[model samples]
Structure formats: C-alpha cells, structure tokens
Target: MNFRLFSQLSSYHADIKRLIKIALPILLAQIAQNSMGLVDTIMAGRVSATDMAAISVGASIWLPLVLFGHGLLLALPPTVSYLNGSGQQHRIAHQIRQGIWIALASCIPLGILIYYSDFALRFMQMEPHMAHIAQDYLHAMLWGLPAYLLLMNFRCLNDGIAKTKPAMVITFLGLMLNIPLNYIFIYGKLGIPAFGAVGCGIATAIVNWSMCLMMIGYSYFNRQERKLQVFSQIIEKPNAATLKKLLQLGLPIAIALCCEVALFAITALLLSPLGANIVASHQIALNTSSLIFMFPMSIGMATTILVGQALGAGAPEKAKKLSYAALLLGLTLTVVTAFITIFYRYQIAAIFVTDEIVIGMAATLLFLAAIYQFSDTVQVVVGGVLRGYKDTKVILYITLFSYWVIGIPLGYVLARTDLLMPSIGAQGFWLAFVVSLTFAAVLLFYRMRKTQSLSDDVLMARLEKLK
Candidate 1:
C-alpha cells in the first residue's frame, strides 16, 4: 500500500511540474494582456475622473467584440493539439491557414462595427464631453482590433504544440511597449497634444499590431516551426469544409463569451445610473479581480492543451489525470489570491481611484469578489477541459442559463429594488455575480466529468482512421 501510494504521489508531482511548464508562460501572457486594460484605466484615471469614466464606458463597447473574436479563435488550438498528438504534423499548416482565413472574415465585420460603434453613445445619454472622448477612444482603438484577433490564432498555434514561451516573450514586450507609449501619447511628451483617454487607445492599437508581428516573426523563424512549415500554405484558398468545422466549434465559444462579458458590462451599465463614483468603483473592482483571474485562466488554457493532446493520443486516463491536476492547482492559487484580496482590499482599491467614496465602496466589493474567486477558478478550469474535448455547446447552454436566466435578473432585483430586502446598490450586482459564477462552477464541473466518461470512446472512434 505504501509503495503504491508513493508511486501515485510521484506521478502527481510530475504531472504538476509538466502542467506548470506550460501554464507559467501562459500565466505571464494572460497577465500581459490584462495589464494593458489596467494600465489604460489607471493612466486615464490619473488625467481626470471624466477621462476614467470615458474609459469604463468605452471598454464596455469594445471588450465584447474583442473577446468574441478571441473565443472564436479558441477553437483552433485544440484542433491543432489533436493533430499534433496523433502525429499528424503535416495537417497543422493547412489548419492554421484556414484559421487565418476565418480570422480575416470575422475581423472585417467586427472592424466595421467597432469603427461605427461610436454611434452607440447616442443611446446612453452620457455627458457630452465624456461621450465624445469615449467615441474617440473606440475609433482610435480600431486599427488594433484585427491585429489583436489575428495574434490569437498564432498564439493558439504555438500553444497547441506546447511552445508557449514565445507567446509569453512577445506579449510581455507589448506590455513594456504599452506603458511608454501611453505616457508619451497620453501626456503629450513630444510635440503631440495630450490625448488623455484617446492616447490609451492609440497606444493599445500600436502595441497590438507589434505583438501580432512578433508572433508571426517567431512562428516564421523557429526551428521546430520550420519543421512543420506552419505558414507554407499561407496563400492557400479557404477550404469550405475546414472553415465550417472551425466556425461550428468556435461560434458557441464566441457566444458563450459574449454572454459572460455582457453580464459584467450590463452590471456596469446598470450601476451607471447610481453615480460616476459607483461606475468607477465597479471598474476598479472588476479590473483587479480580472487581473487575479489570469492565473486560473492560464491554468485552464494549459489544461485544455494537455488534456486534448492526451485524448488525441488515445490516453483517456492520462487526460483525466491531467484535468484533476489542473483543477487542484487552480483551486490552490485562487485560495491564496482570495486571502490577499479580502485582507488588503483597501490597499488594492486605493491603487485604482483617489476618491474616498469610490475607495470605500470598492473595498466592500473586493471582499465579495474574493468569495467569488473559488467559483471562478473551478468554472474556468472545467471550461478549458471541456474545450479540449470540443464540448463547447454544453458550455454555451450552461452559461446562458446561469448568467442570464438567473444571475442577471437577480442582480437587477437586488441592486434596484427592495424586494430582496433593502437594495444594496453596486455591491448587489457583485453579489449576484458571485451566485452566478458558483452556479456555473457546479454545472461545469458535472459536464466536465460527463465529457471525461464519454470522451475516450468518442475520440477513439473519430481518430481510428488516423491511427
């Protein structure tokens, strides 16, 4: 018994080390991407409260679009992983080429939407100056949208093959670039006039394109990548059958992300009627928690790659073990983050805003956010595992029901009405957020288990021809 137990313990430790190898780079990359928004909000807040408000509103406009495309491209990595695991390296170049075509087709419509999205302000009735600044932020940020999305495909390609460090290096470079560019454009360091919130948009757009180029350059020159010739088919025509499958897998992911993003956004929007301080406070709490979320999100991403590769190699037991290891790691990290968030909520809140009212309000919100972290960790890890199995449709259905059917409506009632006892203002929305994510966590956990039970047979049948 002792020897057998020791063997299992050793196996767990090895699996964890392997997961960390992939997850650490991904964690840095996720942090690099989320920090751009943090820096943008902080720099904009430094200029003026109105500037900060403009940023909050503008983020609501652009985030869903960016994340929607991102979620869609997520379908590519698992596809590549399956091929790689099955030793079908020859197909990767073709699959990547198809992803590029899909990205181009998707980005054009989104680019037009974001460019014209400035008109959405007419419906919001925000202050004239804030509205104008927000509009400029959206339009100025447009050039980066296509690059941002196209980079996701490249990143996915690298991630599928477990070459994640290049993505980390490139994204960290973007973060380094984002700060100086923000300082120069936002504060008018040279001959340029101070653009305030608009400067963030300009800086983001530039850094985004740079990251995309760097990823492309890395993919082009890497010795191993050259072995696969991932870009050799760059000029190939879009294969309809391939494109359809990519979209079929990706669109549900896209819609699920849209629903999740909308839940957060609408909470911000609904709280807008409360006051500027309320909206600003909510953004700070959301941003901080989101930064903390990157750790688990990266773990989930790594889990998907590992799990998919294992299943593709016809090792269902290995995949299940990988998922278990990932879940344990994610939960452990969240516990630490939750402690810090709850204990030092004030110190964290003060970093984002100067107003005492906003600071106080945000401290309370962060406490609730700490409680929400566990649920967030479970759901994110499970979702990644499900994505590895290509079981995205169930995720969409569960997210829709959890956030929309129950959570959002509950937030509305708790925040605005006395029916759920006394109205709790902005904190009420966050309270609802906790409940929704918990619901998602429980359901996603069940679905992931179900997928595991059925994944082996399904994956074996599908790839039997390849073998």
Candidate 2:
C-alpha cells in the first residue's frame, strides 16, 4: 500500500515537472509583455500626471479589445495541438491559414472600434486634453492591431507544439526594444518631436510589428515549423466552413473573457466614489494578485496544450491524468503565492505606496486576495482543460453567471448598500471574488469530470478503429 502511494506520488511529480517545463517560458513571455505596460506607465508618469492617466485610460480600453481578439485566436493552439498529435501535420498549415483569415476579418471591426474609442472617452466626459491624448494613443495602437493578432496566431501555433522558448526570447527582445523606442518617441530623441504618452502607443505598435515579423521568420526557418510550411500558405482563401467552426468555438470564449474583464472594470468604477485612497488600495491589491496570477495562468495554458495532444492521440486516460496533474500543480503554486502574499502582505503593499493608511488597507485586501487564489487556480486550469476538449460554451455560461449574476451583485450590495449589513468597502469586493471564483471552480470541476467520463468511450472507439 505504501509502495502504491509512493508510485502515484512519483507519477504526479513527473507530470508536474513536464507541465512546468512548458509553463516557465510562457510565464516569462507574459511577464515581459506586462513589463512593457509597466514601462509605459512609469515613463508617462514622469512626464506628467495627466499623461500617465491618459496611458492608463487608453490601456483599459485597448487591453480588453486585445483580449477579445486573443480569445478568438485561442482556438488555434488546441487545434494545432490536436492535429500534431493525430499525425495530421500536413493539415496544420491549412488550419493556421484559416486562423490568419479569421484574425484579418476580426481585425477590421476591432480596429475601427479602437480608432474611434475616443467616442467612449467623450461620453465619459474626461478632461479634454487627457481625452485627446488617450484618443491619440488608441489610434496609434490601431496601427499595431493586425501585427499583434497575427503574432498571437503564430505564437499559438508554436505553443500548441510546446515550442514556447522562442516566443519567450522574441517577447523579451520586444521588451528590450520598447524601452529605447519609448525614450526616443516620448522624449523627442534623435530629432523626433516629443509625443509624450502617445509615444508609448507608437513604440508598442512598432514592437508588435517587429515581434510579429520575428515569429513569422522563426516559423519559416525552424526545421519542425518549416515542414508545416505555414508561411507558404499565407494567402490561402478562407473556407466558409472552417471560418464558421472557428467562430463557433471562439466567440463564446471571447465573450466569457469580456465578462470576466468587465467585472473588475465595473468594480473599479463602482468603487471610485469611495475615495482615492480606497481606489488606490484596491488597485494595489489587484495588481499584486494579477502579477501572481501569471504563474497559474501559464500552467493553465500548458494544460490546454498537453491535454489536447493526449486526446488527439486517442488517449483519454492520459488526457485525464494530465488535467489532474495540472490542477494539482496549479493549486500547489498558488498556495505558495498565497503564503507569500499573506506573510509579506504589508511589504508588498508598501512597494506600491508609502502612505501608511493605504498600505495597511491594501495589506488587508491582499489577505483576501490570497484566499481567492485557490479558487482562481482551479477555475483557470479547468477552463484550460475544457478548451482542450473543445467544450467552451459551458465556461462562458459559468463565468457569466458567476461573475455577473453572483459576484458583482453580491459585491455591490456588500460594498455600497446597507442591505447586506454595513458597507465593507473594497474588502466586500474581495470577498465577492472569493465566492464567485470558488463557485466557478466547483462548477468547472464537475464539468471536467463529466467530460472525462464521456471521453472514455471516445478512446475505446478510436482504439477499435486502429484494431
């Protein structure tokens, strides 16, 4: 009995190591991408408060739209993973070509929305000068939209095959380029006129296009990728059926992402009237949570790739094992992060602010944030596993209900109204997050089990075919 337990522990450890190998590069790439945003904010703040606000405001708008595109293009990676596992390598180029077309088609409308995002700013009645700066930033970012989408497309292709290191290198290089580019354009270096915050947009656009080209070049030259000949079919006409399938699989994921993003966004708006200190504290805690979130999020992405590959190989049992290992691994990592957040909460908050009250309040919120990591890790990993099985509609349903129907309403009542006892301010929202995310995690786990049970038959059928 002890030996059996030891053997199971060994299996889990090996699977965890494999998942980490794929996840580490992805985590680094995500960090580098986020660092670019941090650079923009810090540099813009140095110029003026209004410039910094404009950059933040502009990012809040564009980032969600970017995530929408990202969600849609996410259909590609699992598809590529499946094809690669099924020994249908020849079909991957066609799949990738279709993905490119979808990206192009989606880019047109998203670009229009971004370019005219100033309308929303106008409606918000923002300060005229800051609004204008924000508008300019969005328009500048518009130029990079296509490159950004395509970069994601090919990056997904590489991720599907577990070739994540190249993306990490390329993205780090982009981050290196952004610092100087921002310096040049923001400060009027090398005889260029200073554009201030707008320069961040310009720099980001250049970096996006640069990274896109790099990934494309890598795909063309890398021996494994070269055989797929993704670039060779760059201009392949879109298939109506293929496009529909991609949309059907992708749009729900996009909407689900929007729902989750909107929850936090709306929460901030609701919390605005509470006072600047409250908002600042909330932002501090939220930012810290988001940074720590990268760890489990990377594991989730790896789960999607690994599980899809297993399923494609007609190994449902293997896919189930991988999913379980990934969940355990994600939970374990979050526990470590949570412990750090809890023990060093005051220190973490202090890094963001020197104000004693804000630091104390943010530290308190960080404790609540740490509590929610377990739920967050579970839901995210299960979401990734569901994507592997091409079952995304359930995720959309669950998040919409959990975040909108349950989390937000509960938070609003607890934070603002006396109906649920005296207002608790930001802590209420953190509690809501814990509740909603835990609700999501439970529902997702059941759904995953259901999927696993159903897939066993699929495995047997495939084996029969082979026989």
Give lDDT tens digits, candidate 1, residues 94-162.
888888888888888788877787578878877999999998999989878889888999999999999
lDDT of candidates 1 onward, in order: 0.88, 0.90
Off by over 4 Å in 1: 44-49, 187-196, 276-281, 353-360, 462-467
* Model 2 spans with C-alpha error above 4 angstroms: 458-467
Model 1 pairs whose backbones collide:
none
Best by lDDT: 2
Worst 10 residues of 1 by lDDT: 458-467
RMSD of 1: 2.4
Residue 415's lDDT in candidate 1: 91
Deviation from truth (RMSD, Å), model 2:
2.2
Candidate 2 local lDDT, residue 284: 98
lDDT of 2 by residue, 1-467 (tens): 99999998898889899999999999999999999999999999988999999999998899888889989988877778877887878888887899888788889889989988978898879999999999999999999999999999899899988899999999999999999999999989999999999999999999999999999899889999988878774488878877777777788898898777777888999999999999999999999999998998899999989887887787888889999999999988888999999999999999989999999999999999999999999999999998888788899999998899999999999999989799999999999999999999999999999878875777446333321
All candidates: TM-score: 0.93, 0.97
Worst 10 residues of 2 by lDDT: 458-467
